[model samples]
Target: MIELNDVHKHFGPKTVLHGVNLTIPKGESMVVIGGSGTGKSVLLKCILGLMTPDAGTILLDGQDVARAERDAFLARFGMLFQGAALFDSLPVWQNVAFRLLRGSLARPKLEAREIAIEKLRRVGLKPDVADLYPAELSGGMQKRVGLARAIAAEPEIIFFDEPTTGLDPIMAGVINELIREIVVEMGATAMTITHDMSSVRAIADKVAMLHDGIIQWTGPVAEMDASPDPYVDQFIHGRAEGPIEAVR
Candidate 1:
């Protein structure tokens, strides 16, 4: 399980997260939705230890992540970044095997390459594609490669940031389906941050709406449509006349 209790983070004069509290049950996919600059990304960063909260406790499987060994804590999770974040200089196989090659959890080169190829196959990529670099692939292929890397380490938990950000509707659906499949296959606890309603519908078991630096509402995906919360209603309907104001 992942739990954040009374978390607070500030950047100089700006406070991003304010007493944000949430608990994600084990093996569940929780999707957090919010508008841009509403601290959704900051919350993920705090959970990942890329940024620390000034106050609060973040626990992963009952262990305090804020104080845990950074490397050890991070090793328990895999992340699929907003942009695939693949290294243009490296071949797809090498990118997927990155952790297995240079970190404390390093494996032998041959074994790592084998594992990378296996993960690539898991994400619906052919073995021959592994020899290609990120620049040689299309956006959808890059996403597949990112998915391959995410599962390469076989992490206990996975974090996906805007998994379908730039994809067309069909491609977005494919990525969402792939994410759902991988999470279930690995039995990994998943938390995804996104603005795409299609992604939320495809990937979420539970949906949490982040607004004004706090979780405004949370419930099963089935209950989201009928939710009485105006903020959620506004977001899902894509309206400009609701409580959420358009920034200048």
Candidate 2:
């Protein structure tokens, strides 16, 4: 459903992505794994139209999307950013229904809150939590709220940026399982960028490793562990010595 061909992006003197190419099939979950500063998030921003590439193209469902109408293109996507990215001032329900509360897709305030409550329930959050501000919730609750928000619009494609970051291992596992269940339930195409191997195993149908601004290896999750590529092996196994260098 999504394709990137020779996609390149540069920020002044730094080149982030170089001729990156990959394809995500419809309703499939693809997890992108990489070290810090490897452009995983940048690649996502480029696809989301928050950043324009210096060269090449990105296609969504065969339509050239690199330069598509920004609003139209973004409307089809939902994103759960690192650290939840919620507005502290808004109530949880309002945050979840932010998009639906404005413009053409806007609904009655009562209806929007009802839908938000329903979505929160789907993510295993209670109705009572909907009225709380983001700062009032625990990290896990905030992440669950983020998930509810991402799926509130029932978007065809969803991007998860470091969903497990900053959470305890158990909480991260819970989020991973929830993400997997939601993706399956909604049949949404998912692209997740995370460094957590457990997240990769729980949420990925396929896995791609990015290094030095390009994909170094990609294959089914089952093959990731046994892959012969030194880079993939190093990443999956958390090895201290391999083709992947340790970050300073």
lDDT of 1: 0.93
Local accuracy of candidate 2 as per-residue lDDT tens digits, 124-213:
999999999999999999999999999998999999999999999999999999999999999999999999999999999999999988
In model 2, which residue pairs have backbone atoms overlapping below 3 Å? none
TM-scores for every candidate against the unseen true structure: 0.96, 0.97
List per-candidate RMSD values in Å.
1.2, 1.0
Q: lDDT per residue, candidate 1, 1-248, as tens digits?
A: 99999999889999888889999999999999999988988999999988888999999889999778989888889999988999999999999999999989898999999999999998888999989999999999899899899889999999999999889999999999999999998999999999999999999999999988889999999999999999999999998888999766
lDDT of 2 at 162: 99
Clashes within 3 Å, all models in order: 0, 0
Q: What TM-score does structure 2 among the candidates reach?
A: 0.97
